[model samples]
Target: MKKLQLIGLILVLAISYQCKDAKKETQETMSDEVEATEVIVEEVVDVEIITFKMEPKSESMVQGEVTFTESDGMVSMSAVLSGLTEGEHAIHIHEKADCSSDDGKSTGGHWNPTHEPHGKWGAVEGYHKGDIGNFTADEEGNAVVEFETDQWCLGCDDENKNIVGKAVIVHQGVDDFTSQPSGAAGPRVSCTGIIN
Candidate 1:
């Protein structure tokens, strides 16, 4: 066993030496070739950056995130909601999509792209443009809401929805979908912007 281990170590060292030699050869090549190869590799990677944020509605703390390169698809999002009540509540993407400072109230109204009411998720005819639907919290009053939409742009060269300029609001109560514009979700407590 000792001899076999020693042999294995020697083989590994030999392979490593060969790799080092290849790296030196590449480094000695024309600088333009190296630069072109690097650019090609970068393009093959197809990188994307997703931004997200979470803001508590009341006293609860908020958490957000941004995910890139999941299963060869461009998907990124975030949620600023946590420690919510033990039930489902409406969470709409505000039309403004801007969550600057000041509690994000300047974000405007629910993202009603279709000009429809909220709470229309699974309905054959339900689902508002801004209506992503209610997120249910556990008994501990904590929920894991995420952000991901094709409406967003992944990079500077890609098309953008201009939603980064808007803000996301977590309603204390469910979306009533009664009134025109925003369902009575109450006030905006916490906020953060979707930045790269």
Candidate 2:
């Protein structure tokens, strides 16, 4: 009887030891899973992309061609505007380029690229992300503007968040960054929508 009792004690000890080993293994597995999840979250990858086109609004009395194309997350914009009276017009991305009218109500405000107020359309950081600036329509009412900047990258995850949903607005006058709001550009003469 004493032997039997001793055997019972030994069995219980073995079972307890086995349970401890299993618990340790389970903890290790959980740790591995957590690490894998973290890696996945850290590898956030997105290439910038944008597709846009603009047309002749009633306000767009000028015959201009604007095109935006994307490749490998990079975009290129080109504009050839004619029929603009001989002067500088503030050209930039508008809040929304619905172009439903000449009052420029269809299109919202300037692109304000850097989220800065309106300015003389040079290379002001916060002026207008889309503020390419002062395309002077000649006696023939024509102007061609072209340039590139990373300031606006579509499909970018976090940097430029409100790009895809914005419009391109052409103002009747130049943009002076210090100006209260619209750079006193009378109104929106043209607009284009950025689509997928």
Candidate 3:
């Protein structure tokens, strides 16, 4: 009977040790799972977006809404316009966000933070940051414009790359690309301020 009792005690201790080891392993696994979840959360990226409306300028009937989305250091611009003539037109970012003027001149010249010459976007000869080129309007005088680039930011610290406190302008004619100063894109027909 004494030998049998000793054996029974030894068996209980072994079983208890196994249960404790399993519990410790489960806790370690849970800790590892929590760490992996934190890593996943840290890897997530943030996306920023801003949208505004375009008003008619320079005695033209052009009007539109513009949206700017920033993600992964790239900025994308989308504009939906109506009341434009049935043909090609030019769009660009201007120096100021002010659109209080009647003729859209309040927005000033093209946004040339780099002080580069006016030319086509991605031109080897150099171009303004705002040189967005052109888009065509449908026979119904409506148009949609989409532009994307990594050279721009929204309310960032880089003054040369940030697009806040700027203006978007729609011109009455096509961008000549070779014209100095403004590409001779004709009169500013629509204007909108890009604010925070």
Candidate 4:
């Protein structure tokens, strides 16, 4: 009778140990699957990228690369330029994508699809959709520009505010913002077409 009782106790202990091991294995597998799913989700987020290469007007080494990324309802722009005079410089989206001219005038005027007068960005009234303000160049002749806004879209989905097929112009002077027409931003130093 004592032997029988001992045998029953051993059997119970073995079953409990096996169940614990099985539960632990199942939990580890689930943890690994969750981690893999998180990685996959991170890899699948949608982001549209557009790039532009700016060519100097003439006798200027002012070259740059601008990248635009669209996510959600806003577009983010980043530009890295070199060989610029130290000070503020104006940047804007021009009416046409034509940058073939040596002086960059071939790109046409500032993009004013909304017919809004030239003014500071985020103003209560009178502001061109292309009025992107200015960027300051360091003493080393390098400039970095970055901003995010929902005022512009990648395509011409809303009226003509789209910038995909337009030209981005880098001016030699600062955009005074309050100046009539185009903020008197001066001549275009570099121009590039925005493309996907």
Q: Candidate 2: where is the Cα deviation over 4 Å?
A: 1-53, 57-60, 71-74, 112-115, 120-125, 159-162
Stretches off by above 4 angstroms in model 3 are: 1-45
How far off is residue 189 in model 2, in Å?
A: 1.2
Misplaced by over 4 Å in model 1 are: 1-44, 57-81, 97-103, 113-128, 146-149, 154-160
Model 3: clashing residue pairs? none
Q: What TM-score against the true fold does each predicted structure earn? A: 0.56, 0.61, 0.79, 0.83
Using TM-score, give the best candidate's number: 4
CA lDDT of each prediction against the hidden true structure:
0.60, 0.66, 0.95, 0.87
lDDT of 2 by residue, 45-138 (tens): 3333343444555555855667665444446677777667788877777776476675656776666545676665554445666666666777
lDDT of 1 by residue, 159-185 (tens): 234444445567666777655566676
Residue 108's lDDT within candidate 2 is 69
Q: Give the CA lDDT, 0 to 100, for residue 27 in model 1.
A: 79
Candidates in order: C-alpha RMSD to true structure: 9.8, 11.9, 4.2, 3.1
Taking the tens digit of each residue's C-alpha lDDT, what string does model 3 give over 1-196? Answer: 9999999999999999999999999999999999999977765546788999999998888998999999888999999999999999999999999999998999999999999999999989999999999999999999999999999999999999999999999999999999899989898999999999
Query: What's the CA error at residue 42 for candidate 3, in Å?
Result: 7.1
For 1-196, candidate 4 gives per-residue lDDT tens digits of 9999999999999999999999999999999999999988776576678888889995577899999888777889899999899999999988888999999988888889888888888888788777788999999989999988987788747856578778888999999888888899887888898864
lDDT of 1 at 151: 48
